[model samples]
Target: MPDARTTAFDIDLYHIDAAYLAWKSGYNAPSAFELFTRGTPFRGGYMLTAGLEPAAEFIGNFRFTREQLAWLRTIKPYEDEFFEMLGAFRFTGDVYAMAEGEIAFAHQPLLRVEASFVQGMLLEAGLLRALGIGTLIATKSARIRTTVGNCSYADFGFRRAHEPIWATRSAYIGGTDSTSYVEAAHRFNIPSSGTIPHAIVQAYPDELTAFREIARLMPKYMLLLDTYDVDQGIDNAITAAKEEAANGSGHTLMAVRIDSGDLAAWARLVKSRLVTAGMGDVKVLVSGDLDEFKAQDLLATGAPIDGFGVGGNLAVGLGSIESDYIGGVIGAVYKLSWIDLPGDDDDRMKIAGSKSTWPGKKAVYRFGDFDHDLVTLDHELAPDGGRPLLHPWMKEGTLLHSHPSLTEIRERAMSNLAAMPTWLKALAPEQDYDVRFSDELVALRDRIVAEHK
Candidate 1:
């Protein structure tokens, strides 16, 4: 094998140091502190600091192998100078961030990385891409988790998701209690659970045969109905469930999942049939491109659906969020603010319309009473009084503290979700959430925007 020295770092660590070095040089920072300081390059009340741990790992262990460097030589405009620079890149930066699973509103910085412009700038792409996508999914997951109440929601979007890892990470982060993809579950420590697929049901001569075989294999399993005849499918599932229950195999009739037809009516009919047959304990799980609007509407009907299996719409971020919820496509640019060295002030700005960024490090305060958990539109709490939501996650390519485990993050997510008003968690928009900017950040943005004009 080629010597480790000649290789690019591990896949996870591939971009951290290089990204940091690139960022620093790209922005021409005199020192790392200058790139992330108050009145320095990054100007915002605060950054929504995320993906630092992975980014840090990337930087600390970054080394381009002879193989990677050789590939570099294959490209044109490959300056010996740039190649030489790439040879020695390593990331060393400080990052302040919100704890994973913290409730963040639009326009708020979720995580911020502070390092020399060279180091920080280099790390930008991988860091943002890693953190932004996950957080976006996690935020959406929190909302969906909120609406589901006590019912179990599983991730069924793997086959339909944009990618495999998304099926794993995004689905789990979003509030799916389980997944049908075993690999996704194994990779992310998510639970894997499911009922029979239509293909399996299609193979059998009749629905009863399919149900008998399935129940025989996994006695405690949930069974899928709605193949040829919806009513017949339910009757078969009931018969199979009853046989499994009677065997005293400790397998009670778990659930009958419905995937087609009018879900509300079908669910009611199925429940009525099950109840009539003394299968009151059997649940009715609904799936099939369910979104918040559909789920909420179904819930409004007081149907017999014990659980909902939302697929494409929830997993892919469909109509749940309005374009305006993106809120003016607010430019949250990461910019090169001030670079204060001995005799040079490289305090400059990027081009306009590229999303202007504020200068200096910053923070935000959310003011409200604990009662009913109200977050006022413009009223900010005294900075000292309100609990600070953002904190230090990393410094100089080392983690500042143990990032909370995924379970902890999930728990925190649930709490924040519980505090939100039902209307805010509604599938459709009533109003944009109100969040105030600190006077400091507001003033800084104004100054920068005016300068750009």
Candidate 2:
């Protein structure tokens, strides 16, 4: 792999080719692009907007390095002038986006870019990647949080994540209390959480030894059960906790993790044993292929599960078969909305079948407790008591304000979720949200369609 320090070449080759062609033709006029998805993921009513920080970072750092330019030269015989243009390329754009952790709906522009045509085209791939994965994981995490309800949840999906750092950050934005990925924890300032793995128990000689040693070494630690036998593991954990208390080590047993077999039944058994031993304060955290649906089912069983450690389902975007949530991709697309030329500004859109896009620069206005949203031309007036979801984040490629801390973003997410109607927050939301276009927007679309025809 190439050095990770430089992000110059983190773009599709077609964008470069198109930009080169545009440079040759002198067609780099002012343009606008909007990033949006047509539907919600997870069969849910809404999506949590995330990744704006990373996307803004990408735009701010847009530039070509000498090494990257040299590497590009070897790919094909390109003119030196084109390379010089690339070396001097910068994203002198204006960006409008929803704040990280805000709730969004279908057809809303999560992000909008206004820049030169070449600059906007070059941003497509990276913007999609950042916003897509970040939003997907955040939405999934929000659903999990809803199901778990007041329970401490940790992201334990580093091994299953396509990109561990991004997954960890997105999970935190969507309401996870902590993450198991140490690098992400340190980098993003997220709380790190985990329990002793099965390997640790095997490495020690026996499960009991592992539990005892970990309890002795750490002030607070979670013991991993089911390394050998679930019953024996529980007994060992209890003994270790009791010994730690008697020895006055000041150590405390935080929780016990059960990673195998019928988790609900095992959680019940573990909780029962802990209560009987007068260690009822010991929390129960369960893992192993846990998803929102499974977590909901487990909680419904009246099991005394104190927390959840979700892995693949939380990080990998594997749509729940039970909930019929679409997975694998968030389906966010960046499309041209308008272009400005000499003495003429033209609204643009794709007219292809179901892929047709709305024309012109737009703004989404929410009315009456998010009861409905209206998409209208950017120049349109907002109705009384309306709130605009998108706000200026960047001007001429510079941030307008400092990015919010992760804790702030997580709190915003929880607040947004709390304000949503109950039906929309349901595990399987079947009702369609009212997202309509203004009368003027509809007229413009019709006129544009007629002109195309």
Candidate 3:
């Protein structure tokens, strides 16, 4: 345990201050409760469950450093005995979750963790942090991917997301063809795509010379064609490409990117120009502030762009979103849903206004052809045709399954989404997909409510 341990993102350290304060106030709860809800209102009908492996990794390796324990003694509330207890903390729990790429509906628990109340409580924040950002990016990425059909796009949102690495990974799983983050490229083995910035074109004595030099070094690179003048850059690139072909070099690229201005109109212009300039094989790529909404709009109007580079809209999702019918940052959360005790089994729930959650250890099951979903109690088996959604990810504190590769995950997303109704796929759909409560689940809710009343 180096000091760097605190610098990283782990619930043990990330929630250390909160955990200490809770201990001081005797803020111990006997059971974990689901404030009973899930889903981002503005993000449409469903979310993609992601970051489970990373979340599991954190819980498995979490530890409190000596310095952390020593500092705890100085923090106002935590007792020495508490620090002693902290010295032996480990997350011994059972976790069930929707697979990483699974589509989740509202009020369905995407993940459930059964640990002692305190341990589970401390995990809420970090788990939410991971799933919130990961799911948001994945959902956002999926929108862009589904909107474009076969047209390609890259996750160029690294510069925009709060967690650059995680966001890129989420976007990849969400469905981007590639990323501009070089480190993530190797880490995930995804294609890394980038090209000369406007700065390179601006610095050159002539755009042609810059392209020529770059082509010599990286012959397959896509050229940035809007730095000086979109048309001029294209002309220079044509001359450079001819030169490369003559010399048996720089012969691979068939595309140039336009980063600014009216992208839809520009995409059409670039396509026409590339065809007339004797480089008809060359394609047009557009980058800038693009999202699924904007891309969807462009495709609707028949933009001739070959690819899109989505940045801010994909990277930095609703940063502080807090509504169901409206939009902003994703509203993903984590909560304890069930607890087992000697001679007793309880399903805990919160009835807080506007934040109420379904009570119990619950499981989600999907209905016909991905049209609707049912949220049911975990113990009460649904004998109906509903297919169980949550699978065992961890048991006895050990990871029980291997995650699919990014490629496979993306394929799952594409395959499943294809079955989704067209109306539900709309950018801002007029109607939400149906998410029903099982009869048993509803009956349990009624019984619990009657008891309180």
Candidate 4:
């Protein structure tokens, strides 16, 4: 008889530990782990390394509550040893990974964890969940960063994101300079930025009063124009900038944001109005359904828009490039490459069907000139027989890594964007990069197939 209790694992990489607990406790992980386990040697060439921090956090805290264990015991015949194992579930695995902010391509051993088979196995659910979701957002945001060029962008997807932490961290990693989420800013030290919502503009008797109240509170606040009348909103915003300047508050109306209508046209019109009103230096910002293509289209006009407030499409993503949106997708797979049990001469591999994993661990190298378009081998071997992709992010539960400020990450992302190849940078027809495994890995793969047969 089939055990209907078993379900699939449907999470990003970092959420694997949580997925394990959830699966054991009668909640479903994302995809079918049974199927995943069957494919011990995955077919894919590389995986996007992501979500290691969150996955590590989940693994370090993975434990079954006594209540949960007791409930499990009540269900059916249970082994005392198995119950004890559950009680003491801790991931003492060591993970080698690329630094979180580093740019990575499709197929490279992004993360490598070494631990007892069970320990590593149990962490899969949570790890995949965290990594998958984050990478998706980061990849999507990278494209927007490309199209928008030097213009600044902010995260405003707090209300729509699956979790607040996800919203905050995802936006941060996805290349947004600041966020509208106050709690995210407080927790992660990410800067909190916002003008007023359209509701605030509509709440007052007139747009001028609403603008006045906001400008008074934070004199240099970014003003949102287009609650009802967009043209009038610009006029009102100009009036507010003038008043703020005359009051000798030293508060300059920093920027005015246009949310709807033909953004390029409206931005130009608003810029003209501000210049006419002697507030020529005041910046114009734009939002509402912003994506990479739209950002490029608006930028092409050379509008006076200073930056953007990217919400839905950027924070989550537009859609998949080659795979599905949900499920344990990203086609990001972890494969068992070596089996060395003490007495073995060297590492061994197991190959079956389209599943043939390279053995003896791996490293990646960039083979091209980074100065020109920054093209890289998807995963090139370093002559030293070591993997270059996995750099030290953390060591022994200590955050040995020093993450740069959000401003810094934004600047670095911009630099990377400028250097990326035109063909690979577009968010369409997922660019196919090259990754080559060493002869030793190929030999190991061949041996596995022979032994299994």
Candidate 5:
């Protein structure tokens, strides 16, 4: 695990320079930065907020280490005063954010930081990374959850995950029933599940022996098929299951996993064979570079697949070529939105072409089953029947409250997913949910732009 006490050196050198320059030039006004993405990931209608726990931790514990400061002295001819400031620095800011697992739209502020200009600048990279990757994985898992419907889904992507720990947590938040990452499971109290690998079957003289041994050891076990011959593997599994039942050793044959071949066809065949052998209750779980699209296709074929164990597609964010839509990446950017100087408060924005951003501290108000969202200046009154999505997370550098449990976040994700409009849930949604800016927010942006002109 990385240190919970994030050091100032964790940020990019440019951000450090920017902060240094700001401080040197006496530009030490309070500033607000909003973390938002310009568009949804995976061509989806919405994203699930995640990584708030880590982001908050980073902000709460942000400090400069002695070693880091010593190293900084070697790199640049910065003054002793700056080092003194760095050594004494602590984040004394406020953070407002949507709860983890809350559904968010493009341009909505998932997290907003109210701090000094230097503090806000220093937080840009870390906040973006933590929230961006976490949100991407969570959104992908949510799509998979939608595809699988009531069927079981588990994360088998640890080996392929960019960061196994975060991926596992995000996957669970996205509605997976379990994860194969044991460490993550232990840390987060997520249910961990897995069966023998193909290598284990290869280690044995025959499939039946391996199956028998696994059944003897485990109270319940899923046999791995397709290591050699699918038919022989299935036959051996059935034999082992029957023998285990007759032996009265209290072992249960829970399911059989198919990792290769035409998964849908194989699942149907496996289901029929299990039913014929009086083991119909046993599940048929399939895994092989699977994603929501493939899972949906397989289920549509009525493959009798009871569960999915997704690996690479779930762990890694390699976008699909067929869909021509990038996966596994959320382009969340942290931009300065408001600056509070002595007796002067200024709204800020970026107007470089399509990258223009909304000015001022903002609030997102959701209404009517996520049918519409209104973005307005933070101080604006909520539209009637509007539910404010952003809430106070931290005040004066201290967390206002503890985060909800992972299970609670997962439930929230599922509930939000269920509330999504039917058309938005489609694998290729053609319409976007209504997201609009309040007239005041638009007017503020216009005024800022006109002033710049």
Candidate 6:
């Protein structure tokens, strides 16, 4: 699904955890959670990390609407003081995170948050939701890009996107050259691309007339070829192009789009006809149930496809989730890693075995040209020839720096993908690229587990 929550008002739904919110806020015993969140697509060994900027933006502007607060008051176990404090709550925490578009491996903390128990805990749902959907789209887009190479890929998932806002953004970040989501185009400064629907031809006297009118209205147009017979649609497109050329509007059909039939065969036939008619400059665009696998199959036929409009599958992630707006959610968690004890600073972690987590503030460092990563205690310095991946994205409620433009972020994503090892990039991974955990940290975790057991 494309971006779901367009306005801040829609965020009132985060009020879902009112009781826990009230309880954690007042439980004053020096509580803290080292939010070591990680999320990815299914069978994924590596993910192109993203959503940090949006998550930070949500945190920096954290708020409960008046209606949301009023509703929270209706829930049981929430005292007046809780509501009073909730109305004034601000995320005055410190955040360290991998830059959006960095390559992130499994079990590594893509983001870490430090603040009081409540300020941090309250943020978990929103942050994880944003991170999960964005990460999913980015991962999927990269997979398609790996297969598509230099051809242009645009996001046509806007209508089917569970939500439009993040979905479009995710698709773009994931590597779509353009998007059909108009508002997202305006907001992100991305070039808007879309084709006329079948309804346009239906509204007109005939397909040829619709194409001619549309071409007159806009010099460049991708005439939808499947609304009627695919063959006739191409013929109409050529006629419209010729008529427009005679009108001196100087427009030829930008491309001929096929939304149905065998994409590969149709694309080959369409390309062949366009060439026979001396319109070789025109391109063939195809769209119909496209995932990376389908896109791969289409390309495998050696069809002359110049562009694609990917829907449904691109909107859904590798795994499915029980949600109306989205088909999936990444499994991510926030847990207490530290709680101040008088005169004591022992490392702390959950001891659930296999569900256990590392303790203390953590840092992720990359070795070489994104060959691998090491997760170490924050105080430890980067290894020789190693570069720290996490940087101070935010500090004490203020942004540490302006966010990189989406173009820059997309370039970074492409760089990360280009460096990926072939095995991990396989649709079914050959092996996992584990993030090396520090020896001392592992020992401390073992010690904690033994004592708890």
Residue 412 of model 1 has an lDDT of: 65
Prediction 2 TM-score vs. true: 0.95
Q: Could you give candidate 3's per-residue lDDT for residues 1-453 as a string of tens digits?
A: 112243223554546665666566665445543322355545576677677756765666566678866766675465678777677777777777777777876777877877667677767766777677777778877777888888888888787778887788888888888999987898888898877788887787988889987777775778998887887877788778878778976356667999988888877877787788677777788887776667777888888878889887788764222223343356766655555555654765556756767778888888788867888787776758888887777776778876678888877777777877877776667777888887888887777767777
- Candidate 4 on 100-148: residue-level lDDT in tens? 5555654455666655555555666666666666655665666666667
Candidate 3 regions exceeding 4 Å error are 1-37, 41-43, 318-328, 340-345
Cα lDDT tens digits for candidate 6, 35-97 = 444434665666766676668667756776677678756764556776777677777777777
Candidates 2 and 6 compared by TM-score, better number: 2
- The sequence of per-residue lDDT tens digits that candidate 2 reaches over residues 300-370 is 99999999999988897778877666686899999999988776648888888778889999998888766
Task: Kindly report the root-mean-square deviation of model 1 from the true structure over all alpha carbons.
Answer: 6.4
Local distance difference test, each candidate:
0.59, 0.88, 0.73, 0.61, 0.88, 0.74
Q: Candidate 6's error at 409, in angstroms?
A: 1.1
Best candidate (score: TM-score): 5
Q: Model 6 misses residue 68 by how many Å?
A: 4.3
- Consecutive 10-residue window with the lowest summed lDDT within model 3: 1-10
> What are the per-model C-alpha RMSD values against the true structure?
6.4, 2.1, 3.5, 7.7, 1.5, 4.0
Candidate 4 error regions (>4 Å): 1-50, 320-329, 341-360, 368-387, 392-419, 429-431, 446-453
